[model samples]
Target chain A: MIRLENVTKVYEGGTIAANDVSLDIPKGEFMFLVGPSGSGKSTLIRLMLRDEPVTRGKIWVAGKDITTLPKWKIPYLRRSVGTVFQDYKLLPNKTVAENVGFALEVLGRPRSVIAPQVAQVLELVGLADKAKRYPRQLSGGEQQRVSVARAFVNRPPIMLCDEPTGNLDPKTSVGIMRLLDRINRTGTTIVMATHDHAIVDAMQRRVIALDEGKVMRDDALGTYEGLGEEE
Target chain B: MSRILFLIREAFVSLRRNLLIVAGAILAVFISLTLAFGALVVNEILRINTLAWQQGVHVIAFLNDAGENGVPSNAHEVLLEDVRGWDEVDQARYVSKAEAWIEYQELFAGQEELLDIDPTILPASIRIELVDIALHNSVKFRLDQQTQVVRQVTTAADSIEQLQNLSRVLNVLGLGLAVALGLSAIVLIANTIRLAIYARREEVAIMKLVGASNWFIRVPVLLEGMIEGVAGATLAVFTVWLGSTSLARAGEGFALFRLDVGQDWFLSWGLLFLAFGAVAGIVGSLMGLSRYLRDADGTGPDTPAGF
Candidate 1:
């Protein structure tokens, strides 16, 4: 339930991050944005979150035009759209439970409400036993799981990820993909930008490739790179 | 409300996390405010003593005994009666030749040559008290011009004038010093808050990303600044009180000036200092939060490193 029509993002130093790009994804679709560096993959995610303003186009998420949304309304936009980063941006000092519960806490949810939701998400991500452990105390995969739990704690309908498994081993990446797949099975839409060919090929989900700020390919059940494109 | 309690708890948690930085901020406020309050107290001390001295004698006019300006020998009595009727004059009395001679002998009893001088040589003075001490110059000029009824005049006006000038200068300089120091303390506090925020920047980034409002992030940091400021103010007020009390106690044996200002005066100022401390802390917190809040909007320095 996200639509971007002729959206473009231009940086100050004359770098066009997203150049007249357009896309539409129906509800409950798990899609991968496959692109090389500087191909506007992250820019698409940022524009969806309204973290960066679109230079010349409209973006609608969940039937509302987010490009016209005021600055103060951006937080509410973010609440409906969960975000995850490659580095697993968890507060190092907080335990896994606190980090996960932080999602609801920022929403001004009461402790009674936040506690159960955080526990459920941690269980879903398979980190139920390590709730008390700090981020540094957990492995790379565990830390990424904690980040995933934080993103999913509020039970948002849409999850946007920028390389969710970039820093993890292949086996860890599989675990993360399985967790994402489980979440997707619950009818939540997921758009992930990635550089991982093996992961994308194995999942065989919808793939959209971009190059030089323009969409190159959009396919259902697509591989990371079609048989001929080597790089 | 639970909201307020949550903010307070969060603020205290941050202060505890950065104990060293918090201490530095409080110490800065303390030192600056101490100097500020100290200057105010010193100026007040001088004012109280000046009031005590001014109450003693307003103006004393020494009359001529020779009557050289066509004045009668009995002019001392006439001058005293005339001064008593003047609007400026509060009370006036004639000191006769015999009284003047006796006062002369009591003053020079240890001097052989001064004791042998003739009694008529000493002037029979008409001591004139004024309605207000500030009217000294007007009365002095009037008496000095009274050549027909009086020959000469003397007053304690010069000393009082000097003291008033000194107090005026001190008032300006003291306040200037206080304002400058207060500003520096504000800057120091802003820097301290910045340091605290920097240490927890990742937490801030996570909070922003997870849909925390900017105000939600700002409340606790503002509270921390306020705590540090109030702590500094308490130390400053106590130190000023101790200093003034000790100075007043030491001046007990010295009868020339009264050092103790009543507690009411100090009590009000102490409360004011505390309020000032709280405001300064808030101002500093706002200053420190400017960049951080701007960054939280989107692409800040703390943005996560990623693809």
Candidate 2:
């Protein structure tokens, strides 16, 4: 459901963030983006979200050619793709339910419709009892679960995860990974950018490795270190 | 409609989140609008006093003691008749020397030494109240041209003119002060809204990422500004009404002029102030949002790192 044909993003000072990148992900596939810092992984996700304009080439997300899309329509593009951040961006003042319901609220859903959907998502994240608690009152793992609940609330066709488990501990990271895996199994394509080598090596998903603004490897079922590597 | 309610709720929540800034905005609106309302009342009072002054005898044409026949001769009668027929004259009353003498005695009733003065020295005159104060000079010139019967034509026109000039100056000064205060209020409101938006930057980012309409985010800020403005304006109107009512009830106690600003006048002006406050609040919030929250293309700002 995602396609990029030679998309290049150059920064203000001529720093090439993503150069001549061409890739495609079929529907319902789970992919891992393994890279070091400044490896164009975040830039690729941003391009898909239309957060930044591409310098050249085309991008199609959910059947729309977003590269030539007007600025006003960027919000529509974003609505079709769910995003989970590394830091679990939840409003500290909002309860866990409020945080999850925020997605539907922004969609202008009626109160009667939003309440049940929010409750269902909170239950899915196993935070039904913690719905009334604030972000600061929740553990880091629980906070990330709230973030996952929010991203999955609308059940969009694709999910873009940018180091969602970057701040979580190993055990918590595995739980988040499992939760994302379960979400992916429901026919939602997931593209997650990460530096977690152990999680990537264990999952053995379709891996796309990037280094210095270019894709270095594309493996159908690859570990974090890529295929044919000694353990 | 429910979406609008949601936006309004968000606005209140944001307002509660930054209570100090909201209070600052409300206070600014109140102070500025109060000054404006006071200036309006003062201007209205000046106008009323000027009208009252204009309603009195504005010009007096004194008859010469050595007229053609006698004191009430043909010359004096003709002059009086001509003045009464003039379009400018609303009413003209002939004051005889005897009547003038009696009036002088009543004016200085406590002064025994001034009562001994001869009554013949007091000239008989026709006191004229004009239809309009602007015709003072023209009416005076008409009497002066009748030099045979009219000895001197005196008028309070110069004093009236000076008072009118003072009123104009005061009006200009009040307008200038009101405009300056209004601009400052706008600036203060913008600052307050800026703080509010900054505090909710994370929420704004999330809303943007979730594909919420720009207006959905902006309406709350705009409503917050308008709320402050309307609240301030209401307080100002109430304060002015209270002060005016008290002054009118204590009428004539302090040897001052009448408090003639009626309730209808106050009501109209109060409505105007409220409308101005609401407009100012909306503009201030829009400015603040444009400056800090939205980009040049009217898109939301870059999402900050939020957790």
Candidate 3:
């Protein structure tokens, strides 16, 4: 579950990133955030992750007030909410297995647990055979899948994907989205931010639209609204 | 404990992958430590030689002429007895005018013609040896106050004073050179670490996003620094030992130049160099991580969703 109460964010000098927005999503629900570039969609996700502090409000993730959590506790908070970025952010020097195992290693997990858990996650992401391959050795779709494997390897309660498919072709994007859908189906709450109208309309998931730092709509099973009259 | 092992494993892997940077850092530490330890050995040798010279020499006192407040014949016997009574005085002998002339003649034997002068014209004197030549100045000062029996006192004071000044100057110069080399070593190490860090900046940012603690991120860099430092220091100690031993053996053939590198000195300096190398490595890691850690904490411009 996630909640935001009258949150606003301002960047250097007086540029508004997010302005006076509030929303809530229940546990185990999948949601899509749709907006154009610079529309505060990324800002909303950043605030939830505590990557940037809200200039003037409170944020709660998984029933804990992250806004008031100490800096030392930020790492523990992040362990419960997995995040994937537009860039896969995989270490080019590391193999697929090493990349996935890295998340658990940061958590100081035991070797006995880490070895088997990493193998299971890699297999779940359909990369069981590519575990030994480096990121550069894989295709863009496969790299994104590795990133997804890394994010979900620890089985966090919530997953946030910020334009994860932004760098791939349309076909690869579809494959990545399907992988995310499969992940969501297993009962981990998923929130993805994107500008892709076609994927949004096709998935027919709950949508939250933003325009100019304010939330414009929150619709269940919503279409990609405000996109040139829905084509 | 397992976390530490994991960190150490990662650090080893990273160091192996970046072998050239590690080598460069090691080389820097080695050269700096070698220069520093070499100077230290040179200083120790100078100190020992100076001590030997001070211990080998005795003081020489010159007496005033007869009628110029000259010492009485009986007073001369009393002065000699008093000098012999002191515990520090190993031997005291009276040098009459005739004996002084004979000693001067023997000293300048090449000029035999000058030795025929009347011995009675030479002044009376006393030759005194102390248990240790370092007490020469104190003995001279104590006897000079006896104006009734002694007029002027002179020992190897000027030579000893000059040696002391030279030692002080050499030490200061060595220290200045060591400090300059140390700073250069730090810069070299910092640059090496920066390049290594830059190569893995993406991985570091990902780790930050995944909730890795600052210590978790720092351990690898610090380990890398330690490895370089230890390797370099070992090399330096080996080189110093080899060089000193070779020089000492070579000096055996030329007895005029005695090069004595004692075992205690070698062991102590070797340990000192190793410690210095470790400190240098840690300093370099700290310098490189300062900027990177600040950026990763979200205080810098690029907040990559992880900080």
Q: Judged by TM-score, which candidate is best? A: 2
User: Which wins on TM-score, candidate 1 or candidate 2?
Assistant: 2
Q: Rank the candidates by DockQ, best first.
A: 1, 2, 3
Across all candidates, what is each one's fraction of true contacts kept?
0.46, 0.35, 0.42
Sliding window of 10 residues with minimal summed lDDT for model 1 chain A: A222-231
Compare candidates 2 and 3 on TM-score and give the better one. 2
Candidate 1: pairs in clash: none
Count of steric clashes across candidates, in order = 0, 0, 0
DockQ of each: 0.43, 0.43, 0.41
TM-score versus the correct structure, for each prediction: 0.88, 0.91, 0.85
lDDT of 2: 0.83
lDDT of 2 at B155: 95
Local distance difference test, each candidate: 0.84, 0.83, 0.82
How far is B212's C-alpha from truth in model 1 (Å)? 0.8
TM-score of chain A of each: 0.96, 0.96, 0.96
Residues B1-307 of candidate 3: C-alpha lDDT, one tens digit per residue: 7788999999899998989888888888888777876777777777777766655446766665444555464777777788889877887777877788878987889886887677766777777767865677789878888877686777775677688789789878877777777677777788888888887777777888888877898888988987888788889888978888888887778643457878888898788777777788888888887687767656567332321
Q: Candidate 2 has which clashing residue pairs, if any?
A: none
Model 1 residue runs over 4 Å out of place are: A227-231, B53-56, B63-81, B90-134, B145-151, B299-307
